[model samples]
Target: MEIIAEFGSSLLIVGCVLGFFMAWGIGSNDVANAMGTSVGAKALTLTGAILVACVFEFAGAYLAGGEVTETIRKGIIDPSLLASTPHYLVYGMLASLLAAGIWLLVASIFGWPVSTTHSIVGAIVGFSAVCIGSESVNWGKVGSIASSWVVSPVLAG
Candidate 1:
């Protein structure tokens, strides 16, 4: 509490910086992946793909990102448990952002296919289980998400 109080502004600043990096990572990896097919098919040039991605990314985020944002913000982890140690939650989130961002950057560089959602969720689950205890995590939600990872593609097929 005291630590957070003393460094609240600093934490917010750091969080914003990390959030920017995470968004950049998403743009580099996920956006590239999305636009790759078009580029490969020669349906669009690299510049065209980038321009299309930039517009649609913003539109998608603004229009449909709320549910996802909510799930990531409050669904996976139970915030009530962190009531006594709010700082831990803050630290965990910061760490998760940094970890996901780095993983995305590396995966993109290697041309590996990856989901940005999975990376961040994995980071959050890991940090919560290790730092805050397993009970702090909502296993049911985690299970649902994990099941979807397998089920969604199969269903699509």
Candidate 2:
């Protein structure tokens, strides 16, 4: 069926895309941000930060990232579910990434402190709302995730 094929293709394409994003996002957001503070403090030169960032990032991701991949759901959604999923989901996701990227670039250019992790999650939710109607979204998931930001401040404090 043409519908079935379309659904399959969309699911696979999006999954692969999201997988690539996960890896890059981890290296870019997690590793780079971690060392950004040191660079800001002038303890490490930009080149030094980048080189060490490359090494430690690769080591951490290649070594421990497997644990993270293990926790991801490969194909929890059935093809039937896929068929019901709107094509706009893909568009929304792309837009979300675009927003986050633009935000991060602008913030970095202006030397404003912002959180990439927060931006990504916000992008996803923003796009999710565009794809599925806001009424269809599970607020519980959003709420729980928001709790992470709240908890982080308490944890840091």
Give the candidate number with the greatest lDDT: 1
lDDT of 2 by residue, 19-100 (tens): 5655455555555667888899999998998889888878876998775334211111112233455455545545666677
Over 4 Å off, model 2: 1-33, 40-42, 59-82
TM-score to true structure, per model: 0.92, 0.60
- Which stretch of 10 consecutive residues in model 1 shows the poorest summed lDDT? 79-88
Model 1 agreement with the true structure over 1-157: per-residue lDDT tens digits: 8868899899989999999999999998988888999999999999999999989999999998998889998999997788898888999999999999999999988999899989999999999999878898899999999999999999999
Model 1 TM-score, all chains together: 0.92
How far residue 67's Cα lies from its native spot in candidate 1, in Å, is 1.6
- Model 2 error, position 93 (Å): 1.5
lDDT of 2 at 71: 23
Scored by TM-score, the top model is 1
- Clashes (N, CA, C under 3 Å) per candidate: 0, 0
